[model samples]
Every structure is written in structure tokens, then in C-alpha cells.
Target: MRKKIQIVRHVVQLIFFILLVLVVVGTVCSFQIGGFQFTEPLGAIQVLMGGSIFFTPEKLYILLATSAILVTVTVLIGRAWCAWACPVMTFNEFIEYIMKRLRYKPVAERGKKKIELGEVRFATLAGVVAAAGISKTPAWCNVCPIGAICRTRSSGLLVAGAEMLILGVVFSANMYEKRFFCKYLCPVGGLLILLGKISSLIIPRASEKCTGCKACEYICPEGIPLFRNPDMSKCTKCLVCYSNCPYGAVKIDVI
Candidate 1:
């Protein structure tokens, strides 16, 4: 079942990445299909912050409504969006594959962390909000990799150049540490991490007969020791531990 879930997740990721490409090519409109429009949580927050330091109640209410669906999902399933549908995550996996084929190793192995850099994502979130409020523009979106691909077509190559540079830096950093942006610097990820802390579904727990081996911890993209008092907020719900556990001690509890 775990292997099946992994296969299903890969398929979902591919489908979403294709949809993202369609948005880039003008084949599909972003955040909308037919009469139903949707807003990603970060985009909605930026809309509220970019206009004014003191936002109007109407604007707040409308953006809140538009962002509600995504927020609700985050609270239910943790960062399943990052694990299952993020275009960047698909790209990250592609990079991982290339690195593997090349036999390249990341600068640091997974479990050597001295500090939790994942918390830096919160600072990144604050920075994006501050940038919007100060510039009175959603300036971060101009360079955000997720939105940048879709924006480049309309914004022209000059603008796309800068966006790609940002994307390049983020992707290149993954060579130093896997999913570096997802772990440390993605504002959207930070927002989702915050929301996912309260997720009411898909909790992982270590079962009896589990040894103190750090296999699960070392394999986690976010470096969470899912087998040893895992921090669910930082968990992307990738289930690497559950799928790869040698002792079959990682039990996923759905509540």
C-alpha cells in the first residue's frame, strides 16, 4: 500500500506539473477553471498586503474567501501540496534523479544538521509580506519560481531572465541540501508549514520493536526523524520513512 501511494503521488505530481506548464503556455488560466476562480494562499496574502499597509475589510474578506480552500487542505493533510502537487517539487525530484545518475552527493549528508534551518522559512514568509507592504507591489511574485514560469510569457524575456536566475539559485542550492528551498526559504512552503502544524490527518508514529536507527531521519527530505518523535509541522507527508522502514516500524495513523 505504501509503494502504491508513492506511485500515485508521483502521478499526481506529474499531472499538476503539466497543468502548471499549461498555465505557462496560455492553454489554461491560473487559479481558475470555468467560472470558479481559486487563489493560492500566498497569492491571496500578497494581494492583501501589496495594496496597503492598512487593507480594506472588503479586500480582506474576499481574499480570505478565495484562499480558504487551500488553507483548509493544508490544515487537513499537512504539506501534501508540497509533496504531491508542487511544480517545484517535481523539478526537485528531476534534479535528484540527475544527481543520482551523475553519482553526485549533496554537500552535507542528511543527519548532520546542527540547527534547524527549516525555521528560516518563517523569516522568508515575513520578508515577502514586508516586501509587498513596503513596495505596494507583489514584488516577490515577480521572481517566485512557482509563479515565474507562468509570468515569463507575458512579462517578456528581460523579466524572465531575473526570474530564471532566482529559480536557478534555488535549484542549485539543492545540491548542497535536498529540497533546500522547501526546507528553508520558500515563502509558500513557510505558509503551508504554519498551516500544516494543525493537520488532523495523516499522522506518523513509531511502533514498538523500532530500533534507534536513524534511517527514517536521514531519508526525510525535511530531515525529520519520523520514527522518533517526528515533528509533523516540518513533515511534507512524503512518507519516505513509512515506505522505506527496514523494520516496518513506521505506522501512519489516519485520524
Candidate 2:
């Protein structure tokens, strides 16, 4: 049963990765081949964050409605968006594949590792401190390659250089550690972690079946100990832990 679940999970992940790649390709091609201007809805989110009120009332209403929907989903399912929907997560998975193909192992092995929360906390704190000290928004978002990719795409640049640069960094980092971006950075991931604690659905451990073998921990990409706290904020509910556990100790349950 565990093997079957793992196979299914891998298949689903593969399909999702393919879909993400296609979306990016299709969007770029629409502009290049079809001569269609690609407008992303998330552009409004960025514009609003930038304090631009140029959008019509109708547009603002739409953006608010979309945000409400996203919040509802997050509230219901934790960071399901990070796990199953985000294009960036898809790209991160692809980078993992390439790293594996190159025989480059992540520095942090599953059971033997934990996400260095101290590092992440310090970095986030530093950002806040810098922002307050200098009265600036800090350089985090400016250097975010996702924003760069969107900007480049909006400007009609096919094969976005910024995206490539980010991919290069991810690949290089993966040669040393798995999910370097997810662990130490990624503001979207940070936000999800903060909100996931109150999520309706959470991953939990079946303590009765658990043997402390640490197989689930070894399989977890985010470096969480499934046995320690199944409701871990960083867990994406990817099911890798549940599928990989030989003892069938991990399961999804309502929190």
C-alpha cells in the first residue's frame, strides 16, 4: 500500500511539473507566436503592494475577490498552494530532478537533518531590522527572481534571463543542499508557514504504528520529523512522509 501511494504521488508530481512547464511555455508563446499580450492577474497584487491605485474599481474588486479565495483555501488546507499549486514549487522539483540526474546529493539527508530555523529566523529578523532602521522595503523582493520573471515576461522577453539566473542559483545550491530557497528564503513560503499553523488540515503521526525508524523523516524534503510534530508549520503536506513511511505511521488529519 505504501509503495502504491508513493508511485501515485510521484506520478501526480510529474504531471504537475509538466503542467507548470507548459503553462510557462504557453504564456511565452502567446506573446511571441500569437502576438497576444499576456496579462497576469497577479500583476494586480504586485501593483497594489506597490501602492498603485490606477486600477478601476472593478479591477480592485476582482483582485480582492481573488485574494479572499486564496485566503479561504489556505485557511482550509494549510499551505496546499505551496505544495500542489505554486509554479515555483514545480520549478523547484525540476531542479531537484536535474540535481539527482547529475548525482549531486543534497548536503542535508532526511532523518539526519532539520531545517536550520535559526538561520531562517535570523535572516527574516535582519530584513525587518533593516527595513525599520532604514525606512526601506529592503532588497528581498527586488532580488526575487519570480518578480523578475514576471517583469521580463510582461516586457515581452522570451526565455527570461532572470528566471534562468534564479534557476542557476537553485541548481547550484541544490548541489550542496536540498531546497535551499525553501529552507532559508522564499517570502511566499515564509507567509505560508506563518498561516499554516492555523490551517484546518494538518499532517499527524500515528504514534501507535511508529517505530522511530526515521524513514519518513529521511524522505521529507523540508526536513521535518514526522514523529516529532506532524502539525509542523513547514510541512507542505506533500504526502512524501506518509507514502514513504514503512510503518504507515504518518497520516493527514484535521487539526
Candidate 3:
């Protein structure tokens, strides 16, 4: 049952990533299909930070609405958006996949300190909000890789050059850290992590079924300790531990 859930999750993640590509391109080109629009649900942070460089004040309400919806969803479902549908997560996961294929996990993950860099994200979130408040600009948006991609089609190679340089740094960091940006530096993820603490959803565990093997701990991307009472706020809801457990020990349920 857990295996089926994991497989379905991967399929959904792939489809969502493809759709995100379309949205990024469609948003830039003003492309649309039969009354449907793709760029509407994303860029919540840039919008919250007083709009992106390309964003006009005319659509300021739309940006605020998107950020509100993101908050609402986080309250309802924890980090479900970050775990599955986020474009940044899609890119980070792709890098992690490549690294995993190179047999990176067995060496780097063992005995490594859990990467709980929430403080870094908090500091970044403070910077974005403060910088935006003072300058009336989405300061972080200037360096956002996905934002650069969205604007490059209309704005030109100047944006893409900066985007590529940032992407190189992010992807290279993932070679050692694994989901480096999402774990440490994503400002929006910091917001989600904060709100998700109050989220009622949780990954339930049946302690009776657990052995001391610690397989679940080894599999979690965020270094979440599955056998222990894991912190739901930090958990991406990736369910890797639940799916990998040889025993039917790690049951997922809501609180």
C-alpha cells in the first residue's frame, strides 16, 4: 500500500514538473488555452514581496491572493505543496536523483548531522520582507532562478545569464548537501515551515511494529527521524520512510 502511494506520488511529481515548465513559458509569452491560464497559482513569494521586477501594480491583488492561498493550504496540509508540486523542489529533486544514481547516499548520509537550517531560512525571510518594505521591490526575485526563466523569453539573455549562474551554484551545492536550497535557504519554504507547525496533519507511527533497523531514518531526504516522533513542520511529507520500511511500521495519518 505504501509502495503504491510512493509510485503515485512520483508520477504526480513528474506531471506537475512538466506543467510547471508550461506555466513558466506560458506566463512569459502570455500564452493561454481556451480560457485556461497556468501562471496564476505560482510566484507567491515574489508577489508578497511587493511584486517581481516584471510584475505590475495592476495585478497586486492577484499576488496577494496567491500568497494567502499558499498559507491556507499549508495550514490544511502541512508541507504538501513543497513536498510535491513546488517548481524549486522539482529542480532540486532532479539534481538529487542524478546524485543518487551515482551512489551518493550510502557515503554522505551516514552519521551526518541532520540539516535543520531553519534559522538560515528565517534570516532570509526577514531580509526579503524588510528589503521589500524599504525598497518597494521584491529583492529576492532578482536572483530567483525560476523567476529568471519566466522573464527571459520577454526580457532577454541578461536574465538567463544570471539565472544560469545561480542555478549552477544551487545544483552544485546539492551534490553534497541534498535538497540544499529547500532545506536551508528557501524563504517561502520558511513561511510554510512556520505555518505547517500548527498543521493537524501528521505521519503516524505504530511503535509496536517498528524494529531497531532504522531503515526509515536512512531514506528520508530531509534527515527526518521516522522512528522517533518526527517534527511535522520540517517533514516534507515525502513519505520515503513509510514506503521503505520493511515492516508495516510507519503508518501515515492525520492528528
TM-score of each: 0.87, 0.71, 0.78
Tens digit of lDDT per residue, candidate 3, span 31-59? 34565433323345444555453457656
Residue 179 CA displacement from its true place in model 3, Å: 0.8
Q: After superposition, how far is residue 104 of candidate 1 from its true place, in Å?
A: 0.8
Off by over 4 Å in 3: 23-60, 104-118, 149-159, 202-206
Q: Comparing candidate 1 with candidate 3, which one achieves the higher lDDT?
A: 1
- Displacement of residue 49 (Cα, Å) in model 2 is 4.0
Scanning candidate 3 in windows of ten residues, the lowest lDDT window is 23-32
Model 2 whole-model lDDT (C-alpha atoms):
0.59
The numbered model that scores best in lDDT is 1
Deviating ranges (above 4 Å) for candidate 2? 10-21, 24-46, 54-56, 109-142, 147-159
TM-score of 2: 0.71
Model 1 agreement with the true structure over 129-165: per-residue lDDT tens digits: 9998888787777768777645555667456687678
Residue pairs with backbone atoms closer than 3 Å in model 2 (clashes): none
Residue pairs with backbone overlap in model 3: none
* Candidate 1: segments with Cα more than 4 A from true spot: 23-30, 52-62, 110-118, 152-159
What does candidate 2's lDDT look like per residue over 148-233, in tens digits? 44445554556667666765785676656776776666665665566566776665555678888877666787767777665477
